[model samples]
Target: MLDFFTIFSKGGIVLWYFQGTSQIFTQSVNSLIKSVILQERTGSNQFTHEALTLKYKLDNEFELIYVVAYQKILQLSYVDKFLDAIQLEFRNKYKDDLQNSALSSNFDFRQDFDRILFEVEHAAKKQIQKGKVMKSFEESEKSKKSVKSMIENKKEEPPKKSGKGKENKPVKKTPVKEQEVKKTSSVPMATSNTSNGELDEETIRKNRERLFGPAKKKKSAADVSKSPKSPDNNKKRVKVGTKWVLGGTSEDAKELDYTDGTADNLDVNGVGVSLKDEELDYVGRMKGELRDVETESESEEEEEEETVTQKTSSKKSSGGMFSMFKNLVGSKMLTEEDVAPVLDKFREHLVSKNVAADIALKLCESVSAKLEGKVLGTFSSINSTVKTALTESLVQILSPRRRVDILRDAMDSKQKKQPYCITFCGVNGVGKSTNLAKICFWLIENGFRVLIAACDTFRAGAVEQLRTHTRKLNALHPAERHGGQQMVQLYEKGYGKDAAGIAMEAINFARDCHIDIVLVDTAGRMQDNEPLMRALAKLIKVNQPDLVLFVGEALVGNEAVDQLTKFNQALADHSNMTNPRLIDGIILTKFDTIDDKVGAAISMTYTTGQPIVFVGTGQTYTDLRNLNAKAVVHALLK
Candidate 1:
């Protein structure tokens, strides 16, 4: 026991300490055991230990605790009578209710003695009553014993002597000689049967017959019982009744392969799977596994379904379609008044621009549907395919009309003296250069003299990539490279030493060369930086470009909108650009790669009232699609 305690104490999971009075509440079994051994061995009372105690065994095995050396502590059992002694000693002890109650009620000696006595007394009374009931039974048993005793006494009495025995005793010995002669005569007759006499001939004939003919068939117990071995050859066959079998039908059973390598018989709902025996075995195992998988999947589906049903049911109980529809449409914070005028103006513009009203209404409905799953319902259980289709329908309706309005306004507000020059100026990787290249190809295809300015000189590949792109589209590309001093001088003429100067040079070159649309692509800049944004401001000041299209990536999420907002703020300092929200329009690049384009579309709406003018759907130059809102919605939803 001491060795067990020592080993257990070193295991680190056990906590040990001593407690007589002072540390009674803090004491534990593990601690008390350790303390006793330590005090005896060390001859010093300076050990303290604590065990990680639990109400139940932790991890199904060892109890956890912490034991450390401390000052002398008294033994717990030595604590004597005092007011609140029990309460203080057992304050945090492992005192189970039943054990504590039994101890306090004095169950150890008195209750056990009383309980045993009660049981013994009750048993003694029952035994006494049983003895009383059998008293009458003893008398009958005694009478039977007496009758047997009388019979035994008569049996022990001597037999009476025969009176005529004395007369017969005289002739008894004289008959011995006569008896011997009779025995000798009987012996010869007994021997005659074995000596092949008349009886022997009859026995020999029977033995020969038994060994040869007159053979009898050996019978089995089953034959005696008359049980048959095999079914009758002419008996009709019955169908095997199993889950996979069809009821009273001539058609063969269909085997199905399931997800888990188990196959099961699946009832045919439509077309049946025809398989060979080997394939059927393989499918049977697969179907069994699939059933397990489907069962789990169904459980999960049921949980999700219940959640949706509960939410829908609760909402339905609260109100009907109008209330539900109101909540659905109500997600858009713009009230009817705020949106109605916009819709009216949108309708008039679409009509003026030759857009069908049916297309416009579909766009509105689809937009509403997109918001339905997100804002109206507690559950996100909308069908993915249905939602995608609805979204596509909306984009198809809105994109073209919005594009027409933007392009028409840009054309109408054109500067007669100045050449049409637009630059996609923003931060790096914002799709600025890519959008410029795409729009240049667009303008060139539209019968315009388009010139692409490769003003992003920080990376050598930037100019090469733009030039390569222009070469593929058969459009003109203008570029230049300058060192720090010459770059500074160019910006002193009213733009920055960096992108601003390059953009200014590109704009002037386009004007002199009579390029209809000089699209200057700048290095991506952090729009949030006042210095970088001011540089863009300086470029616009010097070049006074007709349009400044913010080229944002379709995958840019809402960050593009944030940059657009700050860029507009800095651009306001420029006197040359009238709407320094020079966000004349937007070109959402890489539209093909985005799974959901609604975020990008809504971003454009929130940041710039301007619509997305163009989209780059693929890597090729001809992959650019004119951003018709309806087309974007249609393509994304589809």
Candidate 2:
């Protein structure tokens, strides 16, 4: 039996519902709305909540969602058909009210719902009853004879040897004529391709040779000792290019990564910030002119300018898929079949733009769901309609859910005599430290005192490099400007210390120094590195940074999902707190590298639902820019 059946609008109006049990389904139903309906994951057939199985169907035209819930232990085959039946019946009964956009929950649908539900369930029961066996007298004890008697009946006609005289001689193989009769009566071990199913002469010859073949003889030890052994036999063979050698020197140890402890004896790439002071800014550039991010395009006309794609151009454009729709003549409602081939090509086009395969597929599903039943206008083709829907969906995903005003938030934190801490984390070589420097510059340019937290003690020599950045940033804003105090300070506990403890101490130190903001720099670690990820989670959970930024490369494609998901999952799993601080936002770096494949922006945002706060377009701090969703979507579609 169903626990409940509900009809509700997307605007949270419950039209009508029936409850068969007293159990509260409010939590389960609300969760479905928030996590699925609101999240745009409606392409799924069913959703499970604890002990209940929830199946839903969407009526997009009326913005109605019909949900039915039942116990998972029950095999409710009639639920789907029942939902379809009831939806049609209810829509027909209230067709006049719904078409007029009546926004009331007093819908009279109970009688129609019950009648359809009963009919559907009865039909399902009849179909199930057909496959069931009937217990009768023929299936009783006499039909199941005793084991001994059943075997005794067959024993009387036991095997009769072909000839009594030949049986006494112990004949193994029969004559070819007798064997020819054996093919029909017995299963053949070797099969033949011939129509008669007889073994070919060559097959028969090979079978005879295999069955009566002579065994190979082993050489005796005494005979082997009589002859001298060859030198080639004594010298064991090994792979070429791998000549045996003595123990290697200490210099060879340098090849191994020394992530922890002192390595004075080995030549290594000294760790800290991956970037140098020289890369932060060239000596020729003036430090007085502070440059910030560009939220919009450089030219004012960038918004007004439209990019026209010509179908007849000598160089074929991304309008390749658009041209295919010309053959799909006539205007009508879109079906799954009509849009399947077009969406498949659209899916590939998204993947080509560096969108993750799974993300691209979900986008296509979303597009198909939105346009599945909508009719194309006389002037519009399937091509224009699909393109517009895709553009809107991409823009929606990229749009920030809430404005991230870091300047205002930092100022607010300063008012409370507390530092606004921002932690930077990502896999190795993604330039977390460099981007941190860029962010630090932005904060300082806005006239805020900053503390550099060197929590990346896992890297043996990484602390000093961040110190270099600290010195350069302070040099840009000397002590003379801020009451004889350096605008930026570096707090490092050297290598091989607990990053969590270091960040806690740094925040405390920032409080004491009256620092306006704290920038926590952690060691670069791969997403799959559990120990490091645990340490990262520990730092975030302990410090509870105002904003935790995940730095990623623009050049990354499918790896973007794994990197972000695992990083977020690691924070949630290992934090051990009720509410752990997952990544708050993303910092996409190397924006200058990827040309038109701006799909990374969509891929990262869609994976986490976190806005990309800062985009790193170059090596210098001034290269930072805010994410322009319009610009990114334009590039993606083009």
Off by over 4 Å in 2: 1-4, 10-14, 19-34, 47-54, 69-78, 121-331
* Model 1 misplaced regions, further than 4 Å: 1-417, 475-498, 573-581, 631-638
Tens digit per residue, CA lDDT, model 2, 489-594: 8898888889999999999999998998999999999999999999898888888999999999999989999999999999999999877788889999998888
Whole-model lDDT, model 2: 0.79
Query: Candidate 2, clashing residue pairs?
Result: 271-461, 271-462, 272-462
Kindly provide the TM-score of model 2 when superposed on the true structure, using C-alpha atoms.
0.71
In candidate 1, clashing pairs total 46
Could you give candidate 1's per-residue lDDT for residues 1-638 as a string of tens digits? Answer: 00111112223432322222343333443454433321111112223444222111111011222222222332321111211222222323433522343222311233332343355556656766787785565567666565656665655655545786533333343322323434655322211234322345455455445445456789886675565665565778999866644454445323332234321332211112243454223211211101100112458758988999999889987897556544333223222333344445443443333233443343443333233223223432223323543445444323332333423433443445345667677667766766565555445434455566666666557765664454444312112221111110011122223776777676676556555566776667887677667767777777777667777766665466577787777788654555544667776676666644334654554345555666667664445665455443433332
lDDT of 1 at 545: 72
lDDT scores of the candidates, listed in order = 0.46, 0.79
The worst-scoring run of ten residues by lDDT in candidate 2 lies at 264-273
Worst 10 residues of 1 by lDDT: 286-295
